[model samples]
Target: MKAPEGADLCFPLLLNNSCRKPVPPQSDGMLVLLSFISLLTAALNLLVIISISHFRQLHSPTNLLILSLALSDLLVGLLLMPVEILSTETCWFLGDLMCALYYVVDFIITSSSVGNMVLISIDRYLAICDPLRYNTTVTLDKTKICVCLCWMYSVLYNSLILMDFLRHPDSHNSCYGECVVVLNHITGSVDFVFTFISPITVIIVLYLRIFMVAVSQAQIMRSHIAAVTQQSSVRVTAKKSEMKAARTLGVVVVVFLICFCPYYSPSLMGEVIEDSSSSSTFVVWLLYFNSCLNPVIYAFFYPWFRKSIKLIVTLKILQPGSCDAKIL
Candidate 1:
C-alpha cells in the first residue's frame, strides 16, 4: 500500500504546524557513504583515545594533547556529523529549542578543536626548539589543566553567542519546518576573530619558529655528524624523533587550516551567512570530514598507533599485561 502524504509529517497531530520529512541523500548510496564516514570517524578517534589512555608507555604530554584532540573529534563524529549528513536537514523536525541547543554544542566543539590545535602546536614548538625546558614546561598535569580550561572556555564562549537564541528559539525561524539562527555581520566577524584569527595566529607563529629551528639544527647535525661522540649521538637521535613528530603535526595543522578556511570565509567577506545555505552546508560537512581524516593521519605517521590498532583488533588490549606492552 502507498503511504499517505500526511504520514511524513513530523507532528501528525498538528499537521499545519508540522514539517514533512526532508529529502534524503541525492543518491541511495550517498546516505550509506556518509553514515560509513561517521562510523569510521567515531571508531578511529575511539581507537586513539583508548590507545593513549590504556597504554602506560603512551602517556606522554604530547599523547595527552592528541587524546584531547581525539575526544573533540569523536564528539564531532558521534554528535554532529550524523546530523549534518541527514539530508542537509532543511526540514528540521527536532523543534526550535533543540536547534538552538544543537548549534551551541556545535560551536563549543569547534572552538575546543581549534584550542587543541594551538596547544599541539605549542607542544611541538617546545619539543623541537627548546627540548631542555619542554619537559618541565609542558607537564602532563599542566596539559590536563590546559585541556580542561579549553573546553570550559568553549562552553562559556558559545553559550554567550547563543544566549538570545536560547531565550527565543523561533525568533529567527522563517517557516514551520525551518530551524536556523542567523548571525549578523558584527557577531559573525567577532566570532571569526575569536574562533579563527587568534588561535591560527598562535599556531602559525609557533610552527614557523619550529620550522626555522628545525632547519638550523639539521644543518648543524649534518656538519658535525662525523665528530659527534656516543653520548651526543643518543641526544641527536632523540632530537630527530621529536623533529619527526613536529613535521607530522605540522601536516595536521596545515590540513586543519585548509578545511577551516572555507567555512569562515563568508564572515571575512562582511556578509551574514546562514547555517542552512547550500554552500555553507557543504563547507560545514567538509570540516566534519576532517575529523575522520585525523586518525588516518596518525595511522600513517605514527608506528605506535598502527601497533595499537593491531592489538586492539586482535584482542590483545584485553590481555593482563597489555598496558605495559611497549608498542612504541
Candidate 2:
C-alpha cells in the first residue's frame, strides 16, 4: 500500500518501474461530481444524437453537422472522460497498447470535433450571407460528404502527428503505471496551428460575416419592405428562421472556443505540450465539460430539442410514428 516515502505505489513489486499513485486532485465530493459530469455528458449527447437522427424535420444540413458534433462529444464522454477521471486519482493500468490506442482515439475525436465546428460555421455562413443559393449549395448529401471527409482527415492527420509515438508507445513513459504522450515542440506547434488557430480563425470569421449580414437583413426586413407582399413576408420568415439557427449554433461555437483555448494555451505561450497528466487535470476536464453544455444550450434555444427530450424521457419515442410526429 505504501512506498518508501509513505506514498502509494501502483505496482509494489516492480519497485523502480512502478509509478506512485497520484495524489487526488479533488476531494471525494469532487470525484462524485466528476462522476456525475461523466454520466451527464454521455446522456446529453446521446439525446442530441437521437433527437436529430430520429426527427424527420431536424434532419437538415445544419442538423447533420450538429449530429456529427454530437457523435464526437459522445465519444469524449463515453471513452475519454471516464479514463481521465480514473487517471487523475489512480494509475493507468490499461496497458501500453491500450494507452497508445486511447490517445490515438482521443486526438482523432478532438480533431473531428474541430472539423465539425468549421463545417457548421460554413453552413451558417451560406445560410445567412448567400441565402439565394444556400439550399442548393448545402444539401444533405453534400453535408454528409463533408462530415465524412472531416472524420477521415482527422484520423489520417492525427495518425501522422503521432506516428513515432504510436510505433513506440512506451518510449515517453518514465514508469509502468502512467500513460504519457509527449509531442515534440515542432509537432505540437504544427497541431496547434492546424487544429486550433486555423479552424478557430475560420469559425470566428464566418460567424462575424454571418452576424453582419444578419443585422443588415433584419434592418431591411423591419423597414416595411418585408410586408409589401405575401411572398416577401414568407421569404422574411424563412430568413428569420435561418438567423435563429445561426445564433444558436454561434453560442455553441463560442462555448467550444472558451473551453478549448486553455488546453492549447501552453502552445500559445511557446511551452512544451503533454497529454494525460495531473498538471493538465483542470484544463482537460474543462474541455470535456463543453460536451455536456452543448445539449443544455440546445434545450434552451431549440424547442424541438426540448420536446424530443420529453418524448424520449416519457418513452413515447418508442411508440409507432413517433419520429414522424411533429417536433418543430
> What lDDT score goes with residue 306 in model 1?
89
Number of the top-ranking candidate, with TM-score as the measure: 2
Candidate 1 residue 320 C-alpha distance from true site, Å: 1.0
Q: Worst lDDT window (10 residues) for model 1?
A: 1-10
The collision pairs in model 2 are none
Per-prediction TM-score to the true structure, in the order listed: 0.86, 0.89
Model 1 lDDT tens row, 111-218: 888888788888888998889988889898999999999999999988887787789878866446667777778778878899889988988788778777866776
